[model samples]
Target: MILSVQNYGQNKSIAKDKIKVLENTAQESIFVHYNSSLFMVGEYMYYKIYCLNSETNKLSHISKIAYLELVDKEGERVFKQKIRLDNGFGQGDFFLPVDTRSGNYKLVAYTKWMSNWGQEIFFSDDVIILNPYSNNQRDFLESEVSKEDLQSKSDLRPSNSALSELNKSPLQLFISKKNYGKRDEVIMEFEGINSKKIPDGEYSISVRKYSPVFPNQKKTTVDHLESKEISPPTFDNNITLPELRGELVTGRVVAKSTDIPLENLKIAFSVPGEDYQLKIARTDVLGQFHANITKPYRSEEILIQLIDDNVDGLTIELDDFASPFNSDKVKFESFRLNPEMNDLILKRSIQNQIENAYFKVKPDTITSNVNELNFYGTKGITYLLDDYTRFPTIKETVLEILDNVWLTENKNDKYVFNLRTLNGEFNNSEFTSLLIVDGLFVKDQDYFINNFSSNSIEQINIVKEYYRMGSQIFDGIIDIKTFDQNYAALASKNDMTALKLNRQTEIKNYFRQSYGNESSKDLERIPDLRQQLLWLPNFEIDDTQRITFFTSDLKGDFEISIEGFTHTGKPVSILDTITVE
Candidate 1:
C-alpha cells in the first residue's frame, strides 16, 4: 500500500510510501531569561535557559545540552559555548570584549533535538551592546538637514513634565527615596493590588537611562537610543508559550530510476573541511530522514552522502523550512535620553574605565593543571625525565632508558611503539592503548613522536594493566608530562587535534564596591562607574525577601521592571521608576 504525506502549506508530497511521521513526533521549544537586553563593553551577559515540550507545556528531558551563539550584525559568530542542561534548566554567562563595536547583536539558543524541526524553531533575541571608547560611532541623532540646523530646532528637547508622566504604572511599586545621590542605596518593594502579597513568579528587573524623544525628532527615522523597559514574552492574554528551537535539516531518499522510496537507507552528515565525526541517520519506511544541528553551520553548505553500498541511481531531495518564530511580533517601548540621563551616562562611562583598569592590574588567576590533586586514584610507573641525561631523540630514550616498552620498524619504514608488562607480555587488546600528553588525548603517534622533543619532556607514566574511563576501555595508558604547558601548541602543527580534557566553566567573581561602613578617606580613593548597579538573577519574593541594592555614582531616573511567569503559566509584568539626583 502506498501512503503519501502532504507537506503542510506546500504543494509537494513527502514520504510517499512511508507512515505519517509528523503527527507522531513531539515538538520542543526553548525559553531564555537574560539579565538585560542592553549591555556595555567589558560587562558579562548572564542568562538562564529553560527547555520545554510545546504540546504539554512542561520541561523537556530529551536534550541534555544547549548551544548558545552570539552573532554580529553581519551574521558572523562572535562567540559560541555549549551549555550542559540539568533537568531542562541551564545557566551561562558571556563576557563582552572591550573592543566590541556599538551595534545590534543576537543571542541564539537551541538544543540538538530541536534542530530536527528546523532553524525557524530556534530562540533568538536582539541584544544591543554599547562601547563608548569604540572608534566606530553610531549616530544617535538623525535628520535631513545639517547638524547645525538640527541643533537649532528648539523642539528637540523633550519637556521634563513628560518624563514624570511616563513614570507611572498599574503595578504597585514603591521606592525608599524619591531622589538619590551617586553611590547611594536604593531599596524597592513590590506588592499585589490593595497591598496583598505578590504571587510566586519569575521576574527580571532592568535599570537603564531613560531616553526621551524631542518634538523635532522625526518618527520615520530609526533612533539609536535603547529601550528603557525590559522586553517581555508575548502571551495570549495570560497563557505563556514555549520558546523556539534551532535550525533543522530534513530530506528524503528515493530510487533514481524507478522513483521508488528507499527505506532503511543510512545517510551520513559531515562537513568537508575537517574530518568531523560523521552523524548517521536511517531512512524510515517512507524514505524520509532528518537531523538537528544545535548551532548554525560555520560554512554556507554541508555535505550529505549516502552510506548504502549500492548507490548507482539514488537521488536525495533537500527542503528549506521557514522559521516558526517572528521577532518583529515582540514589541518594546522606545526611550530617549534627556539631559539628566545624558549627564549620568558621562559619569558612568568614567567609572567603568576605572573598574576596567583595576581588573587589568589584578587579573583573575586561572589554574592550568586541572588534575593536580586527582589522578584517577591510581599512580602508575613514573619516570622523571630531568633526573636522566637527555637523548638525541624520543625513540632512543624509549628504547634504551624505558623498560617494558618495544620500538620496532614497520614494513613502511616507519616506527611502531608498544608497551609491555614487566614479564615481557605484550599488552595486546581490542582497543588501542590510550596515549596522553599534558592531560590531552594523543590520537596520532607520528604527531606526538616527531614534534615532541626528548629535552622538553618532564616525566613519563605507564599503566600496564587495562584502564577503564566511562565507556572507553584502553589496553594500557602512556602518560607523557611536558616541562611546560605548551605541548598542545607544538603538536597542533602536525595536523592533529589537541583539545583540553577539562570542560569545566571558569568561575569569575565580578567586582563590587561597598561604601556603607567605609571611612570617608577610603571613599575618595575609589572611582565608581557601574552602569548596572544591581543584578540578582534568582530573586525570590518570600516574607524575608526584601530587595535592597545601592545605586552607582550617577544621577538620573533608574527604571525597575519585573517580568516572569506564574505557576499556572500566566505572564506578569510590573514597572516603576525612581529618580537619583
Candidate 2:
C-alpha cells in the first residue's frame, strides 16, 4: 500500500510536468467575420480577420502574416491569399468565379508561426456559394432535397418561445419593416445597455439567405472560442509586435552526452548543387535557433549543417512548424432559391458575362498607377537589341555591340561576365555585379548566358558605378529587358534562384449605387443584380445607429446577422429576417 501511494504521487508529478511544457509554448488563434455566409458567382466575399494570443485572448503580436484559403469538398484549394497583418488585424476579399460549382465551401485562416502546432487548431468556417451559370442539374436536385429535409426537421423541433421568456440578452435589434420590395431601402436600429459600462461594441452586419440546412453551425466558431477560454495565461506578459521575418526555420540543439542545451551553436543552410550564398543563424539561450532566408531557392532540397568545427557529442533536432487550420466541426447549410429569385439570378449572370466581355476588348481604359513602377531614379547606359541585328549569339551581341564589358572564365569552367571601368581595368576583386532580367534576379550566370537569345533581348542597361540599395551593395548593375515579358518562364527551366518581388496589395472599391427619389424607368435601365444588398463590415453600437441600404432586384428573404465580440471578449450573435417581394 505504501508503494502504491508513492506511484500515485509520481504520476501526479509527471502530469504537472506535462502541463508546464504546454504553458511555456506560445500558441495563436484566428477569428474572422465575413460579410455573408451565402454568395453568388462573380460577387466578392469580404472578411476581416482578428488574430489573438490563445493564452491572453488579446491581439497576437507573434505573427505578422495570415493565410486565407477557400477549399472545396474534394479537398482542393480553389483560392488562396497571403494577407499582411497589422497588429493582428487584416482585411481581404475573395472574388467567387462565375464557373465555380455550386456546393459547400470552407474559409480557413491561420498564421505561419501557428503552423508549429497541428493544422487542427486553425480557424475554419463554412461558406455556401452558388453558381447560377453552372449546369449541374444533379447537384441542384440533391441540394433541393437536402433543403427540404432540413426544413421538415426544423418544423418538427419545439418553438423557442419558452426559452426566450426565461432569458434575454442585453442587446436588442429592430427593423423599420418586416417586409420590403426589390430596390427598396431598409433601415435598421440597434440598442444596447449603457455604453460606458459595456464600452462600444464592434460588430459585422451581413444580409444573407436564411436556410435550415446551414442552421447555426457551431463547430469551428464554438471550438475556437472555447479554446481561447481554456488556454492558460502565458508566463511572459510583455507584448511585442512580431517583425516580418522571411521564411523562418526554427529548431533547438542539445548535447547528447549531458542532455544540456547548447547555446550559441552556429547553423548553416545551403543549396547542394547550386552556388547559393549560405544563410547562418545562432542558437539562443534556450538552444533554439530561427533562420530567416530572404530569397527563394529553386532546389528541391536544402542541406542544413552544423557550422561548429567541433561537433563531438552534439545532436540536432530539426522539424517543420507549419500547422494548418482544421474544419472537423464544420457543417454546411443548404439554400434553395424560389422561382422569382432564380429568374433574377439568370439575368444577373448574363449581365456579368456581357460586362466581362466588354472589359476584355477595352482593357486599355482600365489604367494602373504609373507611380507603382519599380524603376525610379535609375539612370543607366542603355543598348537596344535591334541595333545588333547581325550578331550570332548573345555573348557576341554583348561584346561586339556593347562597350566596357567582356567575358572571363572561372576555375569551375563557368563563364563569368566582367564589368570594366572607364580606365579599361577589370573591376572584379571581391565585389560582384548585379544581373537582373525583367526585374528578377539572375543567380546563375551560366544559365543566363546560354538561355537568352540575341533576338529575344529587347534592351540592356548598364550601371558602371557602384550601386547601393538597402543592405545590398553591387559593384555595377546589368539590367536586361526581353521583347516579351517571358523572363520568368525562361528562368523556370533552369536551376537558378528566382526571388519574387513584393507588390502592394491591390485596393478594391466595391460597387455602390443609389436610386434615391428616382423614377422606376430610370431604375429599370440600370443593371440591378447585386446579390449582396448591404455589407457593413465595421458596425459600432455605442448609441442607436441607423443603417440605410437599398435592396437589389432579387426577391427573397434576406437574413441580417450581427456577429461580434464584446469589450470583455464575450461572443454575441443576433439574427433577424426581412422579406423582399
Candidate 3:
C-alpha cells in the first residue's frame, strides 16, 4: 500500500490505490542556528537558512534528503551542501559561505544527498568562529535578521573585492646636508617613480630625518637605534632610490665618566670613524645626525666625531643642503631657505599642492607598484585602474564605489544625501504618497533590500521629510545603504536612472486576514493593536499630519480621522489643496 498526506496548510494527494514506500518521518534532528561564522582576511559573511516542517514526511522521491557541511578541525571538509528535491513538496534557503578557516565548524545535516553517496542523518553541530572581520556587539547580538530578501540581489560573491590603486606622490625629502665648510661627504636619498605604475608593496618612507644640527631638549631621552639594509639602487628620472646604503663611520661613544653630549644615550653604528666603520649619524629631536653618502665626500678625508673618545677628532661641516659651488640656490626640500621664499607659506604650499592633486594616483596596472593612495581620489576600492588587467571587476567596477567616506572639509551637516529624483525631470510616478523608510515595519524593507543589493548607489541619505496633502510629498527620507548585499548591486544614473527605475509596480490588491495562526500563545491573549496595524504597506506618515490608513498587506492606522484617510473611498476635499497621485 502506498499512501501520502503532506499538509502544511493543506495540499497533497496521490494514492494510486496504494503500493508501498511510506518511510519518511523518523531520522529528524533539525537545529541549525549555525550562525554566521567569523571571517576577515579576505572577508565574507552569510548564514541564511531554511528547512522545516518537522521534516517532510512520507517523503521518497530519491530518498536521502539533507546535507550542509563545513568542517575543519582536521576532520577536514571546508565546505559542502546538498538537498534533494524534484517536484511538489519543497524547501530552500541555505547560504552559509564565509569561505572557511578559524576553528570548530560543522552545520552538517547528512544522510547522504551525496557525500559520495550518503547514509548518516546524524546532524552534527559546532560553528563558533568569534571574529571574522568583526561586526561585533556579538554579531549584533546573534542576529536573527528577519525578512532579509530585501530585493533579490542577483547572487553576488566574488571574494570580497578591492584592487584599485595609483599611489606614490609624496616624494622629495632630501635630508639636511648643505654645510660643506670642507665637504664632509654625506648623502641620503629616496625619490620615487617607476613610470607611475607603483605597486611594489613594503613601503614606508616615514621620514623625520635629522642632521648634525642638534639642541632642543624636552628632558631628552635617546635610545641606541640600528636598522640597516640597502643597496638596491635606482636613481635619476626613474626617481632615485638607493634605499639608504653607504654610511660607515661608527666611532665615539663613552659614558663611564661624564662625557658631555651624552644627555640621552643610545648609539651604535659599530664605531670606527672617517669613511668606513664609524657611521655616526642617527640623532634627532635636537641631537641631530644623519649619514648616507656613496662616495665623493667632497674630495674626501673624513674623521669627525671627536668627543666620547674615538680618540679626539676634527674635520667637520657636512652637506649644507647641496652646494657643489652653489648656483643662485633657491630652496624647498631640505628646509633650506633664505633666498626669500614665503608668499604666505608658498601660497599655503600651492593650496596644499592643488588640494593634494586628487590624492596622487598614476600607478598599478595590475600590481606594478603604487596602490590606493587615493586612486583618482576616493570611491569604493577595487581598482587596477589604467590598462585594467582585472581589478575592480564585478561587472565593470560598479560606479567606482565610494560609499562616501573621505572627510576634512568643514562639516556640511555630516553629508550623504543622494537619493535620485532630482532630475529625469524629478517625477514621482503619481505619488500614492510614497517615501516611507522611518520604520517599525516589514523588516525595514528587510534591512533595506538585504544589506545593499550590490553597488550603484553613489549617494543617498535624506533621513526625514515627507509631507502629504499639503504636499511636500518627501524632501528627505531615503534609507537604502547597501555596500554589497548583491542584488546585482544597481546604481547607474546619469540618466540610466539605474536602468530606468526598474519598473515593478504590481500589487493587485488583496488583504483581509488581520491575524491567522498567530502564536506567542495568541500573542499573550489578544493585545490586538487593531490586528497589528492591519499589516503595514502604505507610506507617508511622518511630519505628523498623521495619516496611516493602509488596508492590506496586513493592516494600518495612525488615523486621527480626516475620515482616517487611505482615501480608499475617494472623497471630495478640505481646502482643496488637492492630493491624488
TM-score for each of the candidates: 0.56, 0.57, 0.14
lDDT, candidate 1, equals 0.53
Model 1 RMSD in angstroms = 11.0
Ranking by TM-score: 2, 1, 3
Candidate 2 residue lDDT tens string, 386-430 = 766657577898789878877777666766667887566878756
Candidate 3 per-residue lDDT, tens place, 292-396, comes to 322212112232322222322212222221101111222111111112223323333343334234222311121122232211123222322232332232223
lDDT score, residue 26, model 2? 64
Best by TM-score: 2
**Better structure of 1 and 3 per lDDT:** 1
Q: Give one digit per residue, the lDDT tens place, for model 1 in 165-221.
A: 323222345676777887777667777543456655444455544433222221100
Superposition error at 360 for model 1 (Å)? 3.8
Candidate 3 error regions (>4 Å) = 1-11, 14-20, 24-106, 110-122, 135-581
In order, what lDDT does every prediction score?
Answer: 0.53, 0.58, 0.24
Q: Residue 513 in candidate 1 has what lDDT?
A: 45
lDDT of 3 at 226: 11
